[model samples]
Target: MDVSWAAFVGVVVLAYLIPGPDFVVILRSATRGWRTGVAAALGAQTGLCVHVALAVGGLSLVLSRHPDLLTAIRTAGGLYLLYLAGRLVLATFRSAPGPDREEPAPGHGDRSAFGQALFTNLLNPKAVLFFAAVLPEFVGGPAPTWAQVSILGALDVLLGLVAWSVVILAGARLGRLLSRDRVRRWWDRTTGATLGVLGGGLLLARD
Candidate 1:
């Protein structure tokens, strides 16, 4: 195979290292607990698997060829991001009636966090396009195109998992430091604003 495994690994490492929605979700979930963070990470990986399947099936090319379809995906993704942002913002305003000493109810169940992470990754058009563009670069090699793409896609997921694991662990450490009610409030607001901006950016994105 003509594929440069080293280069591919380097690129995947860089991509996941850059902070994005997936990173944010994993960090936030980790703040709640490691279990939630793991769930969110797994969920994101599951979404990546979906994209890999699409790439292997050649649907990524089809979407690229059809701008309208890509636009549709972008719009749906943007709306979902906006929805999540709104929820975060609203959560910041909500006051728990109980004392601060009482631990806040768990923010989200594992299933809920998983679903959120899955949808967040799946809705991201950039991820789809990334796979579409990059997978082909390694495809013309001696090994079958499908096999190469699958292997590369799996590598992508593996890199993402490793990167997110670090993010989760670090966030968990930070979460402990910021567990106080006042600090937690500010953290929520910051994350909410970040999500809002990302969603708005996605909405304005042009193909």
Candidate 2:
């Protein structure tokens, strides 16, 4: 019961608010439809669940101790992001033009959206480091360490889901404009470029 609830929420909220691959994926997918956006949000939280499990079970600590494993994961994530970026950029150039489109049919491509979001988050070194490093800072008093970590992780996931839901709604509002082929293409290119930069940074970042 000695948890720093206020500080925990504040930090988690700030983390979610930062622009990252998860945010970009949800925002971009929202432009197509609400289903995609929601799926992506769910996917991201699911990945967060994995992180929470790791933190609660103390595996995250193990990962932090093994620098090589962390580096491997980081490299893989960076490569994956670059792959996604290249796909988006190439598709923009290769696809033929089309008229403005309606929201995609329900369930159509939702699986892909979800999977993309899942890895976008699951492979994130930041998430791994956050769990190993930050989540422990809020633990205090006589409570069990796992219990405290579980509570903090749950709060993080809840706040993140809510924040992303709001972002999805906002992006959906802009769908009308983005539905235009030229605009959507440009948007994809922009996100693709962003992912590319993030990937490169992650690859180049120091421990």
Query: TM-scores across all candidates?
Result: 0.93, 0.93
**Best candidate, TM-score-wise?**
1
RMSD per prediction, one decimal? 1.8, 2.7
Model 2: per-residue lDDT, tens digit, 71-184? 887898899889888887777776555456442222226787898889989989999889988888888889899998888888888899889989889878987787566787
- Name the regions of candidate 2 deviating beyond 4 angstroms: 98-108
Question: Model 1, stretches more than 4 Å misplaced?
Answer: 100-107
Candidate 1 lDDT trough over 10 residues, lowest sum: 97-106
Per-residue lDDT of 1-207 in model 1, one digit per residue for the tens?
688888888878878878888888888888888899899999999999999999999976697578698788888888887888778767766765357355343346789789989999999887988888866776665688888888889989988888888988998898897767778877877887887788888899886
Cα RMSD of predicted structure 1: 1.8
- Model 1 misses residue 45 by how many Å? 0.4
The lDDT per prediction is 0.82, 0.83
- Count backbone overlaps in model 2: 0
- Total backbone collisions for each predicted model: 0, 0
